[model samples]
Target: MTRRCGFAAVIGAPNAGKSTLTNRLVGAKVSIVTQKVQTTRFPVRGVALADEAQIVLVDTPGIFQPRRRLDRAMVRSAWGGAEDADAVVHLVDAPAQLGDSPADRRAQADVETIIAGLKASGKAAILALNKVDAVKREALLGVSAALYETGAYDEAFMISASTGSGVDDLKAKLAERMPEGEWLYPEDQTADLPARLLAAEITREKLYLRVHEELPYSAAVETTAFQERKDGGVRIEQTIYVERESQRPIILGKGGQTLKWIGQKSREDLSVILDRPVHLFLHVTVDERWADKRAFYGDLGLDYDA
Candidate 1:
């Protein structure tokens, strides 16, 4: 039998459900997801099989206006993921793109930025208007027409990544684009991320979900150690780094309840993902320059100087 395998880069603005769609396409939780925007900081490769085709999906970071080094790096990575891919899917939050609220306007602006970038690169992408369940069909059609007129997208699809609606069609479309080759990964493999990195990301997602507004963006998680026990479990140690000393208490909370909750929730997820008993230890540290550190960016597959 002939085999096919290729990369498909999923690019979009923050909170456009790129991670959600990627997880759905891969039939596994390869990338972390939360309510926060720009939660994804790097490209995560999730392997999916559609018929005889193996589609390697690159879940890239949200493309947005870059003000900081980290933001620039993330935007660069998003585009870089598309550069070498066999197919590109530009996901957009439909309701937000068609709304008038200030936050919605900002989301639309990010989409516009991506569209312009696509035009400048002279690349065509499959536009996926996400969150169709939350928007009216008439309004979605209008938005789709306007974006399609930009001539940056080869086709458009309306989907609700949260509900798995229209996702299989998109997966099939991506599968059809795969080049003829040997499968890049084993049939059972779902993600390409290292165990240590995946553990850190899980802890980071928990931290982001627990913290109040804006605090999550200022926090970062690093897996300091991942050790396999003799019996058959794993012990993971991670450090949660915040920008200022004042932020430490915010994460720790009164009586360390907040940190405790974060650890417990993260451990639960790690256990399920690793399919083994996971002992997770978390520590909070104040590092004002954590975002500027080259080592931190390198660990997460980001360009520090971008």
Candidate 2:
């Protein structure tokens, strides 16, 4: 039997559980997830090997309004991820559609945007009503019906990215969409992202957990140094750069409390992910124009011009 392989982009609005879904589908945590919106800023590729099929899952950033250079790049990557996809899964947060909530509105807008993008590319997509674990079956039907009206999605899968409910079914459908070909990656590989980028993503996850408002978006993390020990462990040094000096104290908190907390959390997460003893050194820096600096995004393995 011939093996199958292709790209499947998981595009969705902010906090729509795209990262969580991607991780579940790949059977590993390739992207970070938090309660805050816009936690994912780059296109994270997670390779899923299911029954001799290779599904490269593209976990993109939340599609929303662009207000800054970084935001523009992130939004660009989100849609751009769908360009060459063999399958596009539009994961919509069902609960947000109850009223005139921003997530509800964002959900509508992003669906239209995805439709436009797909139309221009002459491609069809699949709609996945995510977070079904938190809502009712009837409510999910409403979201599915509304999105199906777009005439852009060929299929709809209601799944919960967190509770592992209905996720395997969606993953199987996505895997079946792969073109007839050999596997594109090694069987053991789960992601195309480099370790440094994964390290930065882990730090970004901690930052999003510790910071509030738009601070998480204005800040970027970079892995400055990484060393592997003789005992097969790793030592990593990271820097979290905020766009303004005033934001520094907030991240640092009283007596360096917040920064310490963030560091501990990041280290704990990294240890689990790397499966090794990680000596993580975290520092907070103030960069008045880091967002405007294209090189900064490039360092994170992201497309600055996207």
Per-candidate TM vs. native?
0.98, 0.93
Which tens-of-lDDT digit does each residue in 1-306 have in candidate 1?
688999999999899999999999999999999998899999999999999999999999999889899999999999999998999999999999878998899998998899999999898999999999998889889999999999999988989999999999999999888999999899999999999999999998888888857485788899999999997999999999999988998899899999999999999998999999999999999999999999988988888888
Q: What do the candidate models score in CA lDDT, each in turn?
A: 0.92, 0.83
Off by over 4 Å in 1: 214-216
Q: What is residue 30's positional error in candidate 2, in angstroms?
A: 0.7
Alpha-carbon shift of residue 79 in model 2 (angstroms): 2.1
> By summed lDDT, which 10 consecutive residues of candidate 1 come out lowest?
208-217
The local distance difference test score of model 1 is: 0.92
The CA lDDT at 59 in model 2 is 93
State the RMSD for candidate 1. Answer: 1.0
